[model samples]
Target: MSTHSYDAIVVGARCAGAPIAMLLARAGANVLLVDKATFPSDTMSTHLVHPPGVAALRRWGLLERLEQTGCPAVERYSFDFGPVTIAGTPRPIDGAARAYCPRRTVLDALLVAAAVEAGAELREGFTVEEVVADGGRVTGIRGHARHGSSVTEHAPLVVGADGRHSAVVKAVRPGQYDERPSRTAMYYAYWSELPVDGFETGIRGERHRGWAAARTHDGLTVMPFGWPIEEFHANRHDIEGHFLAMMDLAGDLGERVRAATRESRFVGTSELPGYFRTPYGPGWALAGDAGYHKNPITAMGINDAFRDAELVAGAVADALSGTRPLDDGLRDYQRIRDEEVRPIYELTDAFARLDPPPPEMQRLIGAMHGNQEAMDAFVSVQASTLPAPELFSPDNVARIMREAGADG
Candidate 1:
């Protein structure tokens, strides 16, 4: 078998790994990246970049490249629940930046390119078999070293960015992470000329039907929401039928979404997480979906991946530069990932736990009565600015009550 060496070996060169490798290499580390798939491929993601995520891309100097690779800037997200249509201003970055929807098919390839340009050696189509470690500490990883090559390679640091079923994680911390299936799953696809109807505004998409749909610059419409996995499994034979039916149930906007398409296929995905940890050990750490799979509503998984890559890259740089203990650095990595992003996860989970409102919620909803600011608050809450519990907080209500009392 062939053999090679590097300072770090990163597996799953997609959302997480590619970025991490690039950042580490830019910091002047010798990096080797591995992925079991070809570039410009789709990952199991909704692919909607939030503003903060867009900011991270800018920080990475990959934003312009992303735009060149068919990224769609989304401006507004319209929520339609049957008869009520609530459209809110899309949150912008600084004054001009807006979130974009880029197909992973486009994004991943661009990322791999960036990593390569940043002086990283990327080997795609090389399946990672296991993590190679020394003394219960991460040291290297063993896998199909190159496409059509059974060779193996080792490095000082092994990074797992291979998404949910990370082989690196399975090998490094076997039997460590436990996951809970998401309450809802989705069947979505990309389109070339489709639109989300009235929300002609692009970027962070607006709805056409009751479904949450957005159009990418490449004209891809991503429709995702909560639906049972069992239902999805049962309808595999006619997924398109089920998808259309759900859109119909959603409303005419959904019907518009259904009719707006001429060429498209479905992508199936399930969201699950028991707050998976054990993300770091001796000579390695995990980044992106490999460590934590988020509830979909947050739309922050990819964003979190970028954020994690930055943190993990810094951890590695510090460890390699003799500035800190690797273990301590990784623990700090986990703390940041777990503690800092917990609110986003919790917020998304709250949306996942959505049930018909109680009478009290109905009364509050009645009070909103078609106010744009009310809807802005709603969107901001969903986007994880306002804490989940505080969305309907007593103090907020008290302030509103005082204002209404004075107005009356």
Candidate 2:
């Protein structure tokens, strides 16, 4: 087996891993980025990068490249709840007033290229068979490429940016908290000529059903519908029928979808386990879904991954460069990550249950109807650009109700 060494080894090369590698390499760290799959690959994703994520892309100087790919900017968000359809633009984040839904095939490849260009070593098709450890400290990784010899690489810091089922997490056995069982299952497919103005989410709270549609790359719209977890197995055999039936509940959106042509086979999962693991331990650290995962109901995964990549890269660079102790830097990464994401994590869990809103929430929804300012703020909360507590405060709710001529 061949051996190699680096300052940091980043496993998984998608949104989270690629950016961490890019940022770390730019910070002057020797970075080795490996992934089991090669570039320009598609994975199951909601694909919506909210405004905050778009700002991250801009900061990294990759936003223009994404725009060049012809993925349309989603400038508005609409939430349909049988009784009312609240449509508005979310408050901008860092001057990025628009969201995007680039196909993962395009987005992931772009990120990997940025990482390589920043001087990170790329090892595509590398399967990490083992996360080598010594004296309870992770020291390196052991893996091989397809049809290639096994090799081991050592690094003081090993980052698990591999999705939810991360191998490093398996090896490190990070303690988990706030864990929740899967509450919903979703299936989606691409459709050609499916015209949608922007991001649309429909919630049939009474029936515990929800669906979303967004225009993606190459004039295709990606539509996803979800059901309570209990219904996942019962509807699995006939996903197409159930998917259409659920969309039909969206009224006009359903009409348009039924008239369009599906361009891809259905893909989905019921394995979305929500949790937060101790993000750092000894020489091993976690980022992206490996450290924290929640329901995709809010489409926050990509945004959260981008934010955490920046956080983790900074922390890792500080530690590796001897500007701070490794434990201190890694701990700060966890602190900031949890602080920034906990609110959305809780909201995602609540939405994933697919339960009807309580009477108070229903009242609030009604009060915001026809009030563009209130509607924008509400959508901003869902977009995670605004804190839920701020929008849900009694004063704000009462003000909205007053403006709508409804009882507070």
Candidate 3:
């Protein structure tokens, strides 16, 4: 039992949870943020922060700290589609012409530090044992500390910032929406001295296999990923071997990786289903992977997490300040999140299937060459700042063709 009452209790103190708690505390709400894992610890992540994600960090006042931590800036993008390569600079986000890939160890710790500075009480190494429910509405949580003490904390709202297998999401059992089946299994690791020339590269390999490589936190991260689901299950026992084999299939990235030092153990997942669960209920809400998750094929997880933190925080703040009903305010967060993410979710889901590109896609890829503006638009889809339709629309196609003189 606890006498302390917080306005919000956020579980899982990573990208999503920490920011939500930080914003709440900054709005003068008493917030408690807890995580099972300690800060400065590495978790499995693709780690690329795209331009939109960088903008979110800037808005949260953490981008300077991230830049200070020695994470390299990625200024360009290269997409190798076998017959064609589209190379261009990513569009700037609020004057930031580059993206970043900080190690999760560094990023998470920095976010937690910001939350603490904002007056959120962050409890690392604390595991939520159960969701304390009263009359069918979540009132608090019972959790145990790493060193073995049980404590209960109460709050008006309990947020599940936990990842895909979120305890808070499970306990609440909120209705699900936009659920899509798992498509691609992915494996990735860090390497040293794998040269990229400050460009992040995405290689579309033959037979539907693909790989992405980018500079991040003193090393190069290369991920080999693809589908058919069956292959993932068959290769479960020999993941490292399978991962290396997949990387070997990755055209130019394979050669560079072969020449570089393997600096870390390979990490990956066989299951990555995409979905959006209703983020809020009676007294509980979800954010990050718990509320909405898309396939990592687009490398949008961290960025989306950052974006949703601002959204959820705003909604919660509005409700707490008596500007709107809590449920209505939280629903606004869900609606906006859906509107912003659904397109990317569908695009990434399509990519994750490892299906053969349609003839139209092949033509579109060919069209991007020799046309820098079209190429930039294409890269924006990857950065997530531009919607998929923006590149594929008829008007854009007409302009691209005009620029290429193919329309004539």
Candidate 4:
């Protein structure tokens, strides 16, 4: 055990942990941020960040640093649904109007750096072995370093900002709900000199298969994903062949892939079950994918992490400052995150199933082909600036129809 004590001890210092620690430390809390991995390391991810995430980085004053790394800012988004295409610029979020797809190596390091700059103590390569609890309340964490002996750190509040398979959540075992089976297997890789013309695109091909393309860190990325869960085991052995075959779903994207040089080996996952866990307990809390995860088909994970970090940071800061009881503030954090994420989670789950939408839904999407405002609003929902209902409600559809009729 160690003698040091902090206002907060945050585990898994990436998108979620770093931001939470940075915000709390910025508010005059002594925060300790720990992560198993070192800075500038790669992690599995789609790497896409929508406009709202861009806004969060701007709020933290890190967006300019991210831009300094030369990660391109994607200004346009296009979705192809075989019969029609909806294309538009992303809607602005807090005066920011662009998306990004920087590699994890670039993004995570930046976030960690920001946390350190904000006066948070970061302990990289420290793996948490257990959660130390006393009188039914989490008191701290016990872990060892990559090379040093075992150690322990004390704190009133412990946060798990780890990814979906968080050790903190596993130890605390908070209430979990909305559990669902995996819907699709995903596979993607990078290519050099893939011509994208400065746009990010999502293509829905035959059989409802989904494809995504964007320019990131060093190359263009192409992900051909969404085969049903049942095919996972049988297809694991021939991932490259299956990946190439799936590329045929988008002929244009497929042709580009065939022409471009492969810059990295294919990587992917067949298991991504979605769920929501209670965010807090007596003295512990969860943030980012540790508390909730949705299908990546929507490319919302990074943005969700940013938002979660901000929420958890604010609530924890209030609790630590004695403005509110920790449990009450943490519970409010859970409620707010649920209300914000539930809609997109459901929509992403449905899309991940790779099934055709109902006829009415199809009509609504088809209508977006001609309505630029509606199309842009729909994209904004994906970016998380606007709520889902604003673009999907019956009243909204009627309004779009009336406007279209007037234009005609």
Better of 2 and 4 by TM-score: 2
Candidate no. 1 TM-score = 0.86
The top-ranked prediction according to TM-score is 2
> What are the TM-scores, per candidate, against the unseen true structure?
0.86, 0.98, 0.95, 0.96
- The residue-by-residue lDDT of candidate 2 on 221-289, one tens digit each, is 998779999998899999998887787788999999989999999999998889999999988899999
Global lDDT of each candidate: 0.69, 0.91, 0.83, 0.84
Worst 10 residues of 1 by lDDT: 201-210
Give the residue spans of candidate 2 off by over 4 A: 1-3
C-alpha RMSD values across all candidates: 4.1, 1.1, 1.8, 1.9
Q: Kindly list the per-residue Cα lDDT of model 4 for residues 1-408, writing each as its tens digit.
A: 677879999999988999999999999999999999999788887688888999999999999999999898888777777777777776797988798988889999999999999999999999998998999999999998899888989998899998898888988999999988888888778888787744445545346567778888765664536577778898888977877776676667778878888877878887789999998987799999999987788888888889889888888788777898777778888898889888898888888887777677777777677889988887777767788977888889878767767323
Local accuracy of candidate 1 as per-residue lDDT tens digits, 8-115: 888988878999999989989989988888887876677777666778888888888887766667766565544355566544543433677787888888889889
Best by lDDT: 2
Off by over 4 Å in 1: 1-5, 90-97, 145-149, 174-179, 197-210, 270-274, 357-369, 384-393, 400-408
Kindly list the per-residue Cα lDDT of model 3 for residues 1-408, writing each as its tens digit. Answer: 778889999999999999999999999999999999998888877788889888888888888999998888888877777777888887776766678888888899999999999999988999998898999999999999898889999998999999999999889998887788887778787788888755545545346667777778765564545545767778778876766676666677778878888877767887788888989988899999998888888888888888789988988899888898888878788888898887888888888877666777777677779888889888888887778877888998887777767776
